[model samples]
Target: MDGTVDITMPAELEGTRAVVRSWLKSVGETVRRDEPLVELETDKVTTEVPAPADGVLLEILLERDAEAEPGALLGRLGARAAEPAAPTAEPEVCSRQSAAPAPPALEQVREHRLSPAVRRAVGQHGVDISVIRGTGRDGRITRADVDALVAARASAPASGSRIVPHDRMRRLIADNMLASVTTAPHVTAVFEADFSAIIAHRAKHKAAYERDGVSLTYTAYIVAACVAAMRAVPVINSRWHADHLEIFEDVNIGIGTALGDKGLVVPIVHRAQELSLQAIAARLHDLTARARSGQLKAADMKDGSFTISNHGVSGSLVATPIIIQQPQSAILGVGKLEKRVVVREVGGVDTIQIRPMAFVSLTIDHRVVDGHQTNAWLTAFVQALESFGD
Candidate 1:
């Protein structure tokens, strides 16, 4: 007898909805039980749905980027079977010379000729193309036309990109980043913090922390500082909604991890506000290592109330990081940590001394967070860093 068979969205996994991020199998492919079948993405995470049983994939019910609810059948799995009989109903034939519909008539008819790219962009922008002036031959709307109108009447020069193929993750990143930039009126505030205290704290704890399996890096300190900072400046943890501002009480910070040549992934640390400094360090290390090794799950990237990009890992002194807009109002960028000489007053005597310092930039959505609030948060963040006991 054939084995019992059924497919399901991954359980206990965040974002199991059938918005496709990747497909691990093709139709007619024999898949083993527990093997990944398709990768699904939520706004902030990507996860794979595994095959339900060892069987031949008989049918794919959904295409990539198709939306599906949890527990919806994504495909059928069973032994290969012969083709079934066609429907017995007489095939309806339509005349090619049918009269063109009026504007009202066309409104009811679904147009299927839209290219995938155009469809995606239009759906994403929620654009009403009927109002756009088309420049294509015969007034057919083109992708370029949609893009041009999306960038309409902008004082700043349009950002250009040479067309290049991107994998699913990169594509998602592109879409989200573009959406954030377009939707949010971003304003970046810069802060220069003396890192001497942070250096002393790390130096004092580094050895013991490492012995306990923690890296004891500046990231943990920053994470703690950011948690305190977010609590102090609650506006930084808010999003602008259609009719109101949504404030998030828990701080889930997304740590931006670079994925070598593919792109970057920001795996979130849920409730970073609740995690201790050591716990944050341990989680950050694990996530970063796994992220680089491509072992991260979709849940690791979901539900971020804020983002932290440690661009300083590559020696960048300071950067105006872009905010990931959605349920988050801002992103904090950490620049390279280095020792530099600066003037200091010691016991009323002015002297030059070398001390560790790093630059931080908080890019916030101006619609939700003002510059004064952003600056206040950064100041509080620096104060937190300066207060870390050695």
Candidate 2:
């Protein structure tokens, strides 16, 4: 008897809880090696598990909505077996089929080229693209086209309101946010930081960094400054505990990357204190690109002592009491940088001039640090940015 191949979740998943969203093939279905077999959703991204070998799906060990972690078994395959036994257990969803009618011949070919959203909607609702009028330019099919089709397929929602269920990712984010708020006493201190020196520095080297294939962003400068500030106030890179505060020697900084309607993910720049500005930018670029593309591994989001939320990119001037990532003592929120008038002295004369400025706030867990320490950390952080290239 040939041994069975286990279809398990990959071990490299990090930071957030993961759960099964759906399975691609039902038990007893023939599948090829490396085919996408199941969809797994995490707090940050949705990924697929591939079949280990050419075989029949012999077991459905875990069903949809079940929590799955590294090495957790999802199902099994009877490798190299032409005939496999029936599944011992299966969910009712296994026998369910899409309600929509089959698409036209041309539409069957078009299915291969639809956007991810369209493809998903088409699969779930058995959408017939032949009926969905394209609203995109040049008669292209947009995600909205499939969406409208899906909406048309459903009956009118009561009171003109449609019900949208929370996805696994959204639910995970909600639980984490609620738990963090309840567990940690969040206190915020706002401080203004002048970015003239760093702005000048970025202006000088940004093109060169780009030539080397790295995007030199102000956030990289902020991360470097945060590392410097950590040196001045190590307690800021710490965790709160009932018995004792845990301060980490390594400065792994997690930057909050928003995913719009999908919530947000924090991908850590591991050992940030040890990396140079350019290195920090490169790591951040890689992590952020992967984050947007749903490609970050669990290790990329793990082991952060502190976090930074650059909400200014989204046009916010300032956001107070930005929720801290639990187990982290503090989080830094950098606001929008803009030109502002300020008094300056030149040649023994007082003059008004426009300077680049931003509000940098530090939100700390009271259990880990007090006001003095929080302000001290922000002071150091501001100094690092303002004093750069001087």
How far does residue 230 in candidate 2 sit from its true spot (Å)? 0.4
Candidate 2 yields a Cα-based lDDT of 0.82
Report the C-alpha displacement of residue 274, candidate 2, in angstroms: 1.4
Model 2, 1-390: lDDT tens digits are 267888888777633468876676778777888877776777766666788888888999888778886678899998555567779896567435657666667766666646454577678888778876543322345454565566655755657676544555678888888989999999999999889999899999999999999999999999999999999999898887789888999999999999776578899999988899999999999999988766776778878889999999998989988998987988899999999999989999999999998999999889888999999999999999988892
Task: Candidate 2: list runs displaced more than 4 Å.
Answer: 14-16, 81-110, 113-159, 347-349
**lDDT (Cα, tens digit) per residue for candidate 1, span 221-297:** 88999999988898888778989998888898888888665578788889988899999999999998877665677
Candidate with the greatest TM-score versus the true structure: 2
Would you list the clashing residue pairs of candidate 1?
A: 46-298
By lDDT, who's the top model here? 2
Candidate 1 regions with alpha-carbon error over 4 angstroms:
1-4, 11-30, 39-47, 64-72, 79-164
What is the number of residue pairs that collide in model 1?
1
lDDT of each: 0.74, 0.82
